[model samples]
Target: MAFVPEEDTHRSSNSTYRAVGRADQEPLLGKQLTRLPPSLQRPEDRCHATYAIFFSLGIGGLLPWNFFVTAKEYWAFKLRNCSGPASRGYPEDSDILNYFESYLAIASTAPSVLCLVANFLLVNRVPVRVRVLASLIVTLSIFVVMSVLVKVDTSSWTRGFFTVTIICMAIVSGSATIFNSSIFGLTGSFPMRNAQALISGGAMGGTVSAVASLVDLAASSDVRDSALAFFLTAVVFLGLCMGLYLLLPRLEYARFYMRPVGPVRVFSGEEELPQDSPHSPLVASRPLGSHTPPLRPILKKTAGLGFCIAYLFFITALIFPAISTNIESLHKDSGSPWTTKFFVPLTTFLLFNFADLCGRQVTAWIQVPGPNSKVLPGLSLLRTGLVPLFILCNYQPRVHLTTVVFRSDVYPVLFTCLLGLSNGYLSTLALIYGPKIVPRELAEATGVVMSFYIYIGLMLGSACSALLEHLI
Candidate 1:
C-alpha cells in the first residue's frame, strides 16, 4: 500500500463520509495518486512555491496597467504640449491636459468593459493556459511597441499619434482583466491566503513601478530618457513573467490545481458524509462534486462578495489618476523647484502605492481567519464616501465650490495613504471571502464573476471620472 500520512489516516478513519464528488471523478480518485515532483513534494516547499506563483501572477497581471498609470504625468503632458520639459512650468494648455485626463480614464474604462464581455463569453471556452499566454504576448508586444514609438518621436509626436498610442495601451490594459480573471479562477482551488497574496503582489507591482519612475526621473534631466527607462523595465519584467508562466504547469502546484477533481476526502465506512458539506453549503468539499447546487443559489451566496469587490474598484478608478493628478502643488515655497515639479507625480504616487502594498500585507496579519464576516460587505459600501473627500483635494484658484482642505499638501498625502490602505485591505478581504463561502465547484465561477464586477466598477468609475472632470 502507498504510504498515507498519519494525519491523513486519522482524518480518513474519523471522517463521516468520503467526499461526494462528480461521477466522472470516481475513476481518477480510485487510482493511486501520483507522487509530487521533487521540486514541490514537501508541504512547506509547496506552500512557499504556491505563494510565489500567486504573487508573481498578481505582479505580472498588473505591471502593464501600472506602467501607463505611473507614467501619466510624462505621457499626458507630452501628448498635449507636443514637446517640453515635464518637470517644471505650468502647462501652456490646461484644457488639453484635462481632455487627455478624461480620455485616459476612458481608455482604462473601455478595455475593462470589453473584458467583462470576454469573461463571460470566452473565459470558460478557452483553455486557461492559452488565454494567459495570449494575453502576455499581447502585453509584451504593446510595451515594446510603445517603447520604440516614444524613443523615436516623443518630442515631435502629433495628436494623431498620441491617440493611436492610447488605443494601443487600452488594448493591452483591457487584456489584463482576462489574464487576472483566469488567474483568480485558478487560485479558487487553493486557500484564501493565496488570493490575498495575489492582490498584495499587484500592489507590490504598482509600488515598484512608481518607485522606478521616481528613480528614473531623478537620474536624467531629459524626460524622454525617463520614459525610455520606464518602458524598458516593463519589457524586462514581462519577459520574466512569461518565462515563469511557461514553467507553471510543470510545477506540482499547477499539476494539482489543473486536475478535474480536487483533494480527496477519505472517510470511515461507518460514518455517513452529508449530502452537502457544512464548510460549503452550496456544494461538496471538492470542486467537482456531485452535490453542486444550481447557479441561482451559488449566485445568491456570493452576491455580496461580488458587490463588495465591484464597489471597491469603482471607487478606486473614479478619482485615482484622473482627479488625483489635478491636485495643485502645495509646497511652492519649499525652496527646491524640483519639489514642486515632482510632488504630485512622484511623491503622491509613491505614497499611495507603498501604503496600498502595506494595506494588502496587513490582511495576512489581521485576517478574519475565515470567510465568515457580515461586516465585510458593509465596509465596501462605506468606502464610497471617500470619493468626495478625494475630489476635495483639488486646489485650484477661483474654482467655484471646490473645497480645499489643508492646502499644505500633507493632507492629500495622508488621505492617499488611507485610501490605498482601505483599497488593498477591503478588496483583498472581499476576494478572499468570495470563494470560501461557496462550494468548490462554484468557487471558480464566483471568482470570475467577481473579476467581472471589478472591471465593471472600473468602467463605471471611468465614466464618473469624465463627469468629475467637468465638476473640477
Candidate 2:
C-alpha cells in the first residue's frame, strides 16, 4: 500500500510548505518545531530521562540474541527432515518453534490490542488516555520480563532455551514502541520520510551486526560457540536500548498519539504515530451496530501498517534462516572455504542497506511541482515499488546448500544480490511510509502489528517454498 497525500485542509507554521497534493496533510508537520511548553524541560523530567536512556540501550542490546532464527532453525529444519540425532528440534523435538512464534505474535501485539481498545473507549465510555497508559505499562512489563526470562549466552544447552528468547523478543518489540512514541513527542516529531532514514539507519546497525555474526559463525572452529557469541551480542544491544530510552523526556501519556501534548521525546516504537510525518488520521467514527466489543481489539495505526512491514520482513527473514543453516551444509557438501559463508550474508545486507538508503534519498530530494514538499512527494514513491517487490518475491534467493556460491547455480547468486538491494530499499520505504496510514498515537501498536504481519507473510510464502524444497 502507498501513503495518502496530506489533505489540503492541513495547515502548519512551517511557512516552507506549499499547497501539497491538495487533500489534507494529517496534522503531522509543524510538530517537529523546537518550541514546546515550559513544563517539558522541567527538572523532574530530567530524572525520568535517565531511565529512558537505559531502556533504549536494553532494547538495542536484544539485537544479538538472534536466537529467533538460530534456535528456531533447530526445530523447523528437523521437523521436516531430521538429518541426525543433533537435529531433533527444541524442547525434545516437539516442533516448539510454533509455540514460541505464536506466543510472540500474540503477546507482542498487546500494545496494538490496547490501542484498539483505547480508541474504542475514547469513542464510547472510558478515557482513551487511561487505556493508553495501561497499555504502555503492560507493554513495558513484558519487555522487562524478556531480559530476565531469556538468558542470553553461548552455552550449547542455551541453544534452544528459546523460551527466554521468545519472552525477550515480545518485550523488546512491544516496549520499544511504548517508549518510542514518547520520543516522537519529544524531537519536534519527525516526518514520514525523515523517520524512515533514521529508523533504517538504526535497524541497519543490527543488519550489519547480523552479518558480522555470520562471519564469526563461519570463522570459528566451533559453530556452537559462535552462536553463543551471537546471542551475547543481543544482550549488549539490550543494554544500549535501555540507555536510549533513558534520554527521552517523559511527557504525560495522555493523547500522545494525536495533537501534541508536549515533550515525551521518544523514538517511534509504534509503526506510525501521526506526526509531522504524513501520519494518518485515525477514524473518529464509533462502532456501527450494537457494541459487541470489536473483534480486532485495540490496534489501529501500528497494527495494520506494522503488520505489513513485519510481513515483508518475515519474507526477508526466511532468507536469513536458510542462509545460515543451508550454507554451512553446502560448504560441507561441496568443499569450499568458510570465508565466503560470512561474505554471503554480509553482501546481502549491504545490498539491502544500499537500496534502503537510495529510497530515502529519492524521497528526501525529489520535491514535486510546487517546490520542495518532502511529505507528499515521498508518499508517491511507495506505489512505484511493485516492480522491485515482484522481483524480490519471485526470483529464487541464492542458496549455499552445500559449498559456496561458486558451485551453486550462478543464476541464484546473481539474482540473490539483486533481490537484496530491492528488498532493502523497499523495506526502508515500507517502514517509513507504513506509519502515515493511521493516527500518530498508534505508531507503537503499528510496529508490533507490522511485526505480526511480517511473520504471516514469511510463513505463507516461505512455507510454500520450503514445502517445494521438501518435495524436490
lDDT of 2 by residue, 237-266 (tens): 554444334323243321121343311222
Using TM-score as the measure, the top candidate is: 1
Per-model CA lDDT versus the true structure: 0.66, 0.39
**Which segments of candidate 1 are over 4 A away from where they belong?**
1-44, 84-94, 154-157, 262-298, 333-338, 369-372
Highest lDDT scorer: 1
Worst 10 residues of 1 by lDDT: 10-19
Clashes per prediction?
Answer: 2, 89
TM-score (C-alpha, index-matched) for candidate 2: 0.51
The C-alpha local distance difference test score for the whole of candidate 1 amounts to 0.66
lDDT per residue as tens, model 1, 156-206: 445556677778878887778778887887676565557777889999998
Give the lDDT of residue 369 in candidate 2.
Answer: 22
Clash count, candidate 2: 89
